[model samples]
Target: MNISISSDPQTIAENCADVIWAEDKTSRMLGITRDSVGPGTAAVSMIVGDEMVNGLDMAHGGLMFTLADVAFALACNTRNSIAVGNFCSVQFLRPASRGDRLTATAKESLLDGRNGIYDVTITDQSGRRIVEFRGHSKIVPGTHLAAASGDPAAAEV
Candidate 1:
């Protein structure tokens, strides 16, 4: 809302990501960090904790899915538009243990109208692939920045 970033598409995307990350309590709670963002791309990282593991002593599948989902959501919403995930699927390739740091990177593979497809790869600190996630996102009826500038009428779909 402050318009601190320039009008360049890349800058706008990064700035929009800042706005989104600031209020993403779920990511913050999971110890996730927004590493970098650009047009149609984003990377987030998190560490596995004791509570994040299942009885098998491995990281929960949901935890990895959520990491990839966060990256996908940020990648699609970089154009000032708000996007929500409609569907997603994850393939677990390996296991992760406690204290392991994992990074999820998202790249937009297709964007048609209000629908977009993203591919997210989750890797361990050693760069070994852990999960492959695909997400479908749908643009919603709102702007991330302009609508929050004290003008209620600016929030048109």
Candidate 2:
């Protein structure tokens, strides 16, 4: 969270994306590209695929939820080291098919001391909202997975 740059969301997002995309295999597999990350917002997008579908040929709920979760994490940790997402609530409003492009956006709704709140939304290429989510995250003092390992810089984002 020690951002060296000014309060530019797009810039912060690009920098964070570079680090995250390079290290996270889950993000790579999901094709989750960072669209933007600012003071209180994070945006990411991906294309729907067969592997992500449910029995009805729609994208799986878990994938949708994961996408939103990533957005929330990104938004919550924009300028500081933070642990987030003790709980999340997701509601699917529509279904998405293969080849459809989806974007998930998370915006900070509240931040109080070590706790944070975010509102997330998932949409298709046509700008159709497919799902809505809200999450709560906690900002801890130190790194969780990265510092735990010998290399404190493992998760540089």
Candidate 3:
């Protein structure tokens, strides 16, 4: 809720989209799509696929973690506040099968200037939680420093 500039929600979402779109398998395999971003809420959805499953035929922990991370990113980056994950921990509760649609919802728990915390949940098509993640992100000013440099590989933070 602390953006330096006031703008339409769509503009904020679009700017975040550019970052997500550039992600590789972590985003693609999880089927991550930004739903919306409001003052302090961010939603993202994903679908489980064969490529996202482990040998046990359930969604891989990494896939769930990625989806949760995406939600955390969007939630903490509200108002054009670029955020980077300082630390994240994911707990796997259940498992999801292939073809199951997954959605990760993240909401800001607290924000203190440049530091924010988020709680994210990953659920299956049936709305059963498969994983829960707690992420700590740091907000900073300006556009994504990596994208601004034009070298995405060097932007890994």
Q: What is the C-alpha lDDT of each candidate?
A: 0.89, 0.77, 0.72
Residues 1-157 of candidate 3 have per-residue lDDT tens digits of: 2212224555555555555456545666556777776555677887777688899998888777878888887777665556789998888998888888888888888888888889998888788988889999887666532233454433342
Summarize candidate 1's per-residue lDDT along 1-157 as a digit string, tens digits.
4544345678778888988888899999999999999989999999999999999999999999999999998999988888999998899999999999999999999999999999999999999999999999999886776544545444442
TM-score of each: 0.89, 0.80, 0.76
**Candidate 1 Cα errors over 4 Å, as ranges:** 1-5, 147-157
RMSD, every candidate, angstroms: 3.5, 5.9, 7.3
Q: In terms of TM-score, how similar is model 1 to the real structure?
A: 0.89
Task: Say which candidate scores most in lDDT.
Answer: 1
Q: lDDT by residue for model 2 over 65-106, one digit each (tens)?
A: 989988888888775454557888999998988998999999
Return the top candidate by TM-score.
1
**Candidate 3 — which residues are off by over 4 angstroms?**
1-26, 144-157
